[model samples]
Target: MGSLRINKVKYNGDKYYFESPVFTENVILIEGDNGTGKTTFCNLIYYGLGGRVKEFLKEEARTHKEIVNDTNNYVDLYISINTENYHLRRFIGDNDITVSPFTISDVEPPTPNEIETNLVNLDGVELLPVNRSFGNRIFSDWVLEKLNISVIELYQGYSTFKVNFTELFRLIYHDQQPNPELIYKQIDTKSNYISDSELLRKAIFEQLIGKSSSEYYDAIVEAKKAEKEKLLAKHFLDEFEPIIAHLRGAEKVINKPFLMTELEQKEMQLEKLHYSREAFKNNRTANTTIDIALDDSKSIIISDEIGLSESKEKLLSLFDEKSKLFFLKENTAKEITQVIKVIHAHDQLNLFSADTCPYCLTKVERVSGHCVCGAEIDEQQYERFFYTSQEYKEILKSKTKTVSTIELAIKGCEEDITSVNSDIEQLTNNIQNAKKKLRSILDSIDQPIDIETLNNIDDKILSIREQISLLNQKIELENKYEKLSSEYEVKRKAHQSAELIMQGLEVKAKQEIVTKVNDFSDVYNLLMTETLEDCRSARISLDTYLPVINDGEYKEASSGVSIRLMYYLTLLTLSLEDENVPFPHFLLIDTPETAGIELSNLKNCLDKFSNLQSISNDYQVIITTGLSKYPESLANNRVIYLPNKANALLKTKSQSQPL
Candidate 1:
């Protein structure tokens, strides 16, 4: 069935009546130059064809700048689709379109419909609703219906210039550049109050905790990234911290006087040896030194002193023992022997004892044993050797000094060992800390969900995926089931309506759908003239999805001009032979001549278009174009001239607004 047509259009409280002839043929043309009110006239005709024109005007009227705009007082359109049929009368005087009046009056075709609130027959067959002004209905929906196919398949398989807004606007009427996304497509169909897809999914994911596709991907990615970073930090810590902790723990043994070094231990041992030697010296019965100078250079000596008198012991104790390393036995045996070893560290001699020497075997040795030799040498015998004795004492002092220095130096080594131990302890503590970090990182990575928890997410995703899958399958299965159901319903209704052709019993107007009224060869010939490839039948099969380049690349039916043409030709060819169809045979097309289409293709298309206007008075076709052309057989078609008061290329200037 074809769309309802409008024959004549008029308005109340207006300066003039804008008139244009209705087109009902295979080809019709409406011509004018650019900026000549062609778009306005197109809108007018579209408005008369059950489009929401007055409503669009009302919306435009409420704009903030509309205060200074001219108001539409009243509007009306007379529709003539069939000569013996009805005329549709539509009125839009009221400022509010919600209460605007529209009625259908019988003229020549059939009965009139007066009901309100959107007029349509049952069974879901009705005038298509427009989303935007032109691109929505005239292009997307109407074209698909004319081609006798679904719109979704046609759009998915589209292979041509992409349908952005600029191209779309240029197609209808050359204007400014249009926004890319704003050019509507089936996928972009949306309501005024629309929510973002990602945002909606985010909120749902937050509440549901991982069910949707986006949620699954987002959660997985987030967890993986977070877990990976955490693990990376922990992995670094794990490598360094153990060594640090180990050092920290081992530092205890190194910090202070654990004094475990061999050198330090040996020094302590030497100290003990010194103390023992001193004790032996203190208890030994030796020639004690009690010197009192009498004359010139001589002194009396009483030796057999082990521990000295109180005054002498006090004097000895007051001296620093380190000086003992510098003293030595002298050659003045009886003279200096009593005091030679006084400041020294060791007394290998046995005092007041007639014993053999510990190192050399000399019998009955006394004070002489304290010397390196065992002979009782006279003072004069040793007198010449004084300088040598002095040198000899220096050598003994240097030897003992070297041993004490070694012991003292070894004492310092203990402290360094303590510091190394402290370092080990710190390292040990660090290691422990690192282990803790590693554990936490591991936990976060795997996200340890119990089997039950995992099962829940799995079940939900499976359920949703299954639902989508089943819905798809059911859609495929629905065709067969629906066909059977419809056939069954038609047969079942026959019992109710006795005169019905298939099922229903109600007595209604005789109806018929002449799918293709023209000769198949003629229609093919007309359609093929516009193509390079050999053409087949142009009448679309019930299952066909329009022209395609290959088996895959399909032509879009949602095109402003193509759709209009598709729709017009569909009805024209269907009613061409006998001229009997359910809907109007006449078509009123607005100016499409200036849509920047190829001149040859448009003419070829128009040629096929003109063929629909069967020479008889049964069918009529009228079209508007910016390029003027009056066909030979259709000279009687009316011409509309909008007042070109000034520059033809200028945009419609707006009047200044009042404050």
Candidate 2:
């Protein structure tokens, strides 16, 4: 989240610790008379952060940065964020740095806990994710349920292998912008057109249009309500219908009243009499009146407080062959039979409808929902009866047996009808509830999707994805074709362009670049020299040429525009470079302002490198010089001065150095 500082090692060889003067001004002006180790501090900061400062230096003679590169046994770094401190350190044993940092508390960099990895690597570097989450920023993953990029995109955009939101801040810090001038420099400086165009359009589209993944994704998001509604519909259909059917079928029984007639009650008494007669007759011949009835038609079935035995309800029951019979009320169904000493008080069977026994019948009371068998029937259904059917038959006739059999069949059919009707009611209830659920889902904001519809949509989406995949393949083919075509053009054009430029005065362009490099060197002379006359310039050399090359007897051999070309190409391909590398948007220039006695020549060199760093955006130029050697005409901007000498301190010196 913030910059890290490494061994600003304020100590020299044997010092216990390094102490720094306050960096009060964030715009650091690290000036110390002349030999104040300002460059040494810079070198320490640079090398401490894993930068190769000597590579940028022109001389083979080493600075402390180089010395640190060679013999440094310790490296440290401190990070500042949210006004808090974090530190990292590494020590040299055999070779390598440790993978993960050994973190320290609220302290500045170069902690004392570094360990040596003792591994040597010359080929490449290892990159590892940081141990701590990025917390100083306003963006994080916890804010969203899921996403490809962090919320930082709301302000700056997310990072990539190349440019993104964090990089935007860095650009801001460097005062860089993609203004017209920089764009031109980027385009004009690039030597390769294919690299300029490849992947170029994609970046432009992202900045201008954004989220190539949003087309189908956004569409599905928009349709979420409808999809949820469909799912709700399907759920309702599956759950509610069967329950409703059961309830309806159960309640319908309340509407269908059952009744028995007087004649039926008399028949029930007659059947009992027949049993009693048969039992008595079997014991003696006087039972002739029941088996071979004499004038039996007028016998008038009657009983004086006659009672039915418990087993007499079974019409053909032989177990009660010795039991007496009771003059039961005909309205009393066999199922409602109960124990009684007397069956009647009237010559006419004195009875209301008989009620079934409690435990034997699982009848449930409507009000309290207890079984009617266990509960008293205080309701009106107990006393009421309709004369639906009746019979007054002889006691011993086969017709009684046939009627009993038919009654059994009717009872069985009634039970089956009730069961089937319950099923139908359940199915109907299911259908109704299903409809309700479907309607609810249909009206909901996020409709539940139908399984069938979802599958269909999935198929459609799959088809679209397949089409996009095919399109991607086509794009790949087109890219390969374009690349091959560009290669053909490059090979074809290189020869023609070279031959044309070679024969023409275009070779003079190489001479111009050589002169420019030389002019650049002249600016450096003013710092090392005493007088303008002693500032005679040196010429520049290049190993390669652009558009033309000549090995002219190794004497008048001309160093061509390759240097200029390399510089130009770097500007052009800057977007594609590994962005992790360091670059100061506005360069800190060491110029030969005093020694380039030819003002025109110095002006010319200034014009080129200045134009280079100042391609566009917010680049600046800061030149350091002394009043005695530097020319006044060229110091158009604020010129920093050493003021006096003798205020320098070196942080790290060679272990055995003689300074």
Candidate 3:
């Protein structure tokens, strides 16, 4: 257990000093009247221990301006913690305190001159600032380290704060504040660092009683973070469920294995369609070869038909020439007959003239070889009247020659017509056979192939391939969903494990707290019943750790002073009896008789402090009160006595002179 004890306290000014009686007892009393600076004496000790008593010091300086305004005035406190002796000095109106090891004997109080010499020439003294704004070495750090207490950090709302020595001192020092119902020092509302939260109050109590530790609170914060992460994972899973389900539904509709099979079937069908089209093309190529030959045959037939038409035209021309020759031959034969008749008539006329006149039939005589009618019987006359026999014969011969020429032309024309008819008939027969062969070849080739059917097969193949592509995408989505689900499961298990660990630690800490609280309540009820006049029952609350009187809420009353006083005494008593409690086992209470508390009740409360001392000599309780109110039983515990306002705790000169 840790311990703190005050050995000596001295007040040093420029030309004078006032020193306290040696505090060699566990329970010390400072008895004085109202104006004698008893509260000032108590506050000096508080200030020397790194407490913020500036406000109280201001009030004290106001009341005793002459004594406090001394520029060279300061307080020196000699103390020991855990058996290590030290000296602390604090100047008036200063936030800095000087601390150093004291090797001098504190068995006897130092004289004024010795203290003044020590204050002027102190070595190895460390100056520590009490102001939090300095951000340097603090006075609490030194004191708390000497007391073997670790600074604790607390998390409240969103901000983290530290529980310092000043805050913890609130429970140790019960002040002369008028609020008697207050269980702890009234929270300084003007200070931003202090909070009026019940959470902070409970945390301070838990720290004092050793019910909570930094490690335990750290576990709680970690558990909450894990829980938050787990919920986020769940939210992601819930949001992803619909998208995963939609992809799954699409996969179900398509049926992957079956879709793959159908794709294969469609591909095979497309290949067959391509093969069939190729075969049809090959057949058409063969038919084209046959058609080429037939085209050659038809070309020959067309040539023959042209020759036949030319031959027929030539035959008709020959027939026309033959008809003209026949007409010329008949006309030439008639001209030959007419020329013979002319010649015979001329010979008959010459014979008749020699006998008689042919026309008159009288006997006639030739005169110069002429007829009597003056007809000339000479060849010249015959030439003029009719053709001569030789001439007639020549004419008939020329006519006979013309008739022969015409007969020969008619025969030649008939021969050409006969030859042309034969040629025409042969050409016509050849053209007829060629047409029959062309018709047979046309019937032998197959029909044209359907192009539209190939187009339909291509469209179906493309459609099937698109469906297969969609199925592949769905499969990929499903894989991603599986991975996410696996991660979510891992987070879930981690959250569960963290929650179990936090619960176990909490359960163990609570069990210890309940045991200590029960022990504390027993001491508290005993003190309350003894101190209050009408006290029926009293106990410490399990939840708030406040005093409950007669199964009711603690309210504002004069008796609350006794209740608060006993509550502090119970804490001090528990520190002695309970090993788990971490209370410093020291208290500095000032004037518990305030708030109009009854004199009898105040005496009962004072007796409780004596009772605690009887139970254990390991603790210290320093209390100040009016001299008239001081109980006779605790007279042995009185360490200082100020008779009246004339004999204040501090003087202007030495102890020989009054201010």
- Candidate 2: residue 86 lDDT (0-100): 26
Q: Give me the runs in candidate 2 sitting further than 4 Å from their true place.
A: 1-19, 22-25, 32-40, 46-72, 90-659
* Candidate 1 TM-score to native: 0.32
TM-score of each: 0.32, 0.23, 0.54
Clashing pairs in 3: none
**Using TM-score as the measure, which candidate wins?**
3
For every model shown, the clashing-pair count is 70, 26, 0
For each candidate, the alpha-carbon lDDT, in order, equals 0.35, 0.31, 0.71
Please say which candidate is ahead in TM-score: 1 or 3.
Answer: 3
Off by over 4 Å in 1: 1-5, 14-29, 58-68, 81-525, 530-541, 548-567, 578-580, 593-596, 613-615, 629-638, 642-659
lDDT of the structure predicted as candidate 3: 0.71
Candidate 3: where are CA atoms >4 Å away?
Answer: 55-68, 107-125, 133-137, 211-505, 553-556, 654-659
- Local accuracy of candidate 2 as per-residue lDDT tens digits, 1-659: 11222212333222222345322221222323445444444444433333334423435374444334543234444433223332322332211221222223323332213212221121221222211135432111211111222222211122112222222221112111223112111221232333244233223222211222122222323234233444455455445445444544553322111212333444455455444433332122233333333233222121101112221233223223212122121223332221111111110122222433334432233443222345655455543431101111112123435446556655665565455456545545554554554443334323232445445545555555554454454444445444555555554555455445433423443344344334333332332122222323322233321111121212111111112222322321231122211222222222223322344433443334333333332223333322333333344432233444322343333222211
lDDT at 485, model 2: 51
What would the per-residue lDDT of candidate 3 be over residues 1-659, giving only the tens digit for each residue? 56788887777665546778778889989888887878878777887787655543546434446445565566778888877777777766667676666555643434434554432223344657776663465888787677766566566665555667777777888888877888998653335443656777777777677634433555676676676777887887788878867756644444446656665776676577666645543223355568687889889898998898899889889988888888788778777656544433332122333445667655576466564667667745633543333445457668878888888888888888889998988898889888888875665466554547756756665775676566556655555555667767887888788878878877776876787788888888888888786788888787998888989955458988988888888888888887557788889888888889878768868976767655778788899998768677788888788889778887767357432
| Two-way TM-score contest, 1 vs 2, winner | 1
Candidate 3 RMSD to the correct structure: 64.0
